[model samples]
Target: MTFKNTLEFAQKLDAEDKLARYREEFIFPQHNGENVIYFTGNSLGLQPKSAKRYVDEIMTDWANLAVEGHFYAEKPWWDYHDRFAQKLAKVVGAKPAEVTVMNTLTVNLHLLMASFYRPKGKRYKIICEEKAFPSDQYMISSQVRFHGYKPEDAIVEIKKREGEHNLRTEDILNKIEKVGSECALVLIGGVNYYTGQVLAMEEITKAGHKVGAFVGWDLAHAAGNIALKLHDWQVDFAAWCSYKYMNSGPGNASGCFINEKYHNLKDIPRFEGWWGHKKDERFLMKPEFKPEAGANAWQISNPPVLAMAPYLASLELFAEVGMPALIEKRNTIVAYLEFILQEIDKEVPGTFEIITPSRQEERGTQLSVFLHGQGKALFDYLMNHGVITDWREPNVIRLAPAPFYCSFEDMYNFGQILKKGIQDKS
Candidate 1:
């Protein structure tokens, strides 16, 4: 789909979009009463209008039933967390029992680490990307420290070759092989938050397993933005926050996945809480901690129904428009964005370059632009002009044109703004 100009291209793409109707479902943020071309879905997705209704339903139950809402309401607040599991499982390609909605992203990462990051005498190191999200880095470092290991000795950080923006799979595989005997776990983001580089999960999992190390993923940016097959990939454990791409509200309840193979593993120690106890035997209040068979066994506390509401709303939207179809649409828009961005780069030489992979399958919806010298200024100019996107430190601006609501027009408009912003700054 070539465009004569940005506007015409946007209008044409919007006309052909199968998911175009979904745009009406969200509340687009406005600046000075004008709708902003929201490309920041990679940071915090716009709220679905149905989110209000979902919250209201719970609110109504809370109002009328009060204390009884837990046991007597229509959906029964006591089991409300289970209501979201089926749809969430579909989104991430896991069996219903293998997935559960629970605590926030960082918290869940720690909980999963407790169960999966067991480091025996010789196998005590963990491998992760060099620029993982700050919270993830903190969690891994602290976990290593808690287990009586120095982070320098226990954490192995992988970086790309000099001048390269993305890590190569071969390099990662080699690193895993080199340290396989000493490595206990491999934790990585499905799509890097800063570079938008999608790692080869299947190959990574295979490499880790061959070396007898556990594999887990931090899917905060990948969930809903990309298609995931956790079970098929043999991902031992995974965790994600629902705010980005999922269109769930800010700080929404997070989710986790555990392979069914671990369902019967008795030696894997987990930090136990009452909510994770088997449901039927929960009321018995038995002293022994007999965990529920699958991912629910990892839960520590009762779920926050309010936090889960927005996620349920988002998952219903995902189910309505399946992931494969969404991925196809996303690939088209992302390619178009890349094309235009490259055009801009050509016009203003040496100003900016896309750091995300060029291959369609190697990325999700995001394009991380590396600004050569004036990144912060250019980012500020775009933001002030109402072209909203995210800026990472040192020098990269990330834009994700989410398929659920973003139009080709939004991308074209963003290109126009970006070109103008770059030229003006140059």
Candidate 2:
């Protein structure tokens, strides 16, 4: 489909959009008198209007039921985390028993590593992407250090080909093969935070398994933005935060997936707490830790209910629209966004370049643009003019037109703003 940079063309596309009405479901921030063009969903999603109601319900339940709220509240605080299993499993493409909600993203990754990152003797190295999110880099390094190995020796980073903006699939697989017998684990961001590149997770997971490595994904940017089949991919484990595309509040609870094959493995070590004990036996205060039968076994404590309330609210939206519909709109809006960027780039020749992969499957809702002749001045201009985007260090601007709330008109308007910002600088 041809994309034209015009208000009428964009409005026409919006008018025909089946998901456009759902945009009203979100609450956007005002820039002057109009809603800002929100392109930072890869960092933080717009809040759902229903989030307040969800949080209020928990507040009301606590006020009325007091100590008995655990058993008597409408959602039953004792089993609040259980409510996420089915809804979240559908979102990430896993079985209900294979998924659970628990700590924040990094915390969950650390806990999961306690079980998946067993580095015995010769098989100690972990393969990850170069320039991974700082938190992941810290986590992997600390884990390696705890196991008595220097990060330089244990972490094998798959570097991008000299001048490339993204890691090639062949380079990643070759790195795994090179690590070979030394590769104990393979963990990569399912969607790269920097370049917005969606890695070939299934093929990478296969290759990792072939090399006797436990493969996992940090789905912080992938979970709600892409179509993931963690179970079918045979991913050993995975974790994702709910705040970004999931539209949960900032720093909210995380969703986790542990393959069913590992559910009953008693020998696998985990950092256990009462919440991970057998449900029926939890209140009994058993002397020994009897692990919950599925991913919940990784829970370190009872869930933070307030933190999870918004997540449940967002999952309801996911259930209503489903991922298939989201992906359909995502493909169109993102392509349209790319088109807008190209149109604008032509106007301001050689000023910017989209570092993100051109293929639909190789990218998500985000497009990371490499500003060539522009800098923070251009970013500041866009932000000051009602365009909310994410700016990385040096000169990259990450624009994520989240399909759920971002409209075609936003793409057109952003293009206009971008072109003007460049021309003004000149």
Candidate 3:
């Protein structure tokens, strides 16, 4: 498709967008009087318009039912988390039985590691990507320590080739093979939080399994951004937070995937609780621990219905507009954003460098731009000018043209703001 940098071209794309009608569904942040051109959905998604109604319903139910709300509420608190499983299973590409909504992201990560990260004898090393989100690093270090091993010895990070921003698929696969029998688990993010690089999850899963390592993904950035096939690809387990791409509000409950094979694996030691007890026997307060089948077996406590409400609202929108539509819109928006970026780069050489991959399949809608000789000043300029994007560490700006709520006009305006910022800085 031919590209142009004119406002008319941008407007034309917006006019033709099939998903344009969904833009009003989100409540964007305001700057001065106008809504900011939000490009931080990769960090925190905008609130869905129906979020209040969802939460209000729960509040009303609680007021009326009191303690009986567990079985009597609009959405029964007893089975509240179960409501998202079928929908979420579709999102992460898993069977309904294999997926469940549980605690927050890191909590689910720790829970999954507890069940899957059983370091035995010499086969105790774990592999992850370098520069993974800090929480993951801390979690891995703590887990290894709990298992009586030093992090430096038990954790093997797959690093990028010298000076490269993203780790190559072959490099990660080779690392798995090199670790071989000593590799007990391969846990990595589906998308690198900083670089916006989408890893080859299927290949990675296969490589780990080939070497007798349990494979899993931290899909915080990938869950709602890209199409995944966790079940089809035979991924052992995966977890993701909904606050970002899923627009489930800040620090919402997370979704988890456990391959059906583990549902019956009685040998695996798990951190169990009453919520995970067999549903029929849970109300009876049974002394014996009998876990429910599938991923629901991992639940620690009854889900917080009020907190899960916003997720239901966001997920309902996702169900209305399927992932295929979202993916199509994302591809075009990203292409336009990339086009504008290339033009800006040509106009002001060395001002910034795009670290995200150019290939559509290799990334989501996010593009992480590394400032050359500049710092947060340019980011501040964009923010002050009504462009709400995320900034990372020493010098990187992360912009995401979220498909569900963000518009083509927003991307166009973002490019315009970026161009002006460059011209002013130069």
Model 1 clash number: 0
Q: What ordering of candidates by lDDT runs from best to worst? A: 2, 3, 1
Give per-residue CA lDDT, model 2, range 1-426, as digits (tens).
Answer: 988889999999999999999899999999999999999999999999999999999999999998898899999999999988888998898999999998899999999999999999999999999999999999999999999999999999999998889989999999999999999999999999999999999999999999999999999999999999999999999999999999998888888999999999979988999999999999999899999889988887888998899989989999989999999999999999888888887777899889999998899999999998778999999999999999998789999999899999999989998888999998
Note the Cα lDDT for every prediction shown: 0.90, 0.94, 0.91
Report clash pairs, candidate 1.
none
| C-alpha RMSD of candidate 1 | 1.3
Candidate 3 residue lDDT tens string, 1-426: 898988898899989999998888989778888889989999889999999999998899889988888898878888988889788888888999999998899999999999889999999999999989999999999999999999999999999999888889999999999999999999999999999999999999999999999999999999899999999999999999999999999898899999998999878889999899998889899788999988989998988888999999999999888888899999999888888888888988888889999898899979999999778889999989999889899899998999988877787788888888878877
lDDT of 1 at 170: 99
TM-score of 1: 0.97
Q: In model 1, where do residues sit more than 4 Å from their true spots?
A: none
lDDT tens readout by residue for model 1, 1-426: 664445876798889889999999999878778778888899999999999998998899999999898898777877888987788888898999999989899999999898899989899999999978999999999999999999999999998999898999999999999997998999999899998989999999999999999999999999998889999999999999999999888888898999999988888888989899998898898999999878898988887887888888888999888899899999998988888888777788798888899988899999998889886999999999888888888898898999998888888888898889887887
What's model 2's overall lDDT?
0.94
The per-residue C-alpha lDDT of model 2 at residue 349 equals: 84
TM-scores for the candidates: 0.97, 0.99, 0.99
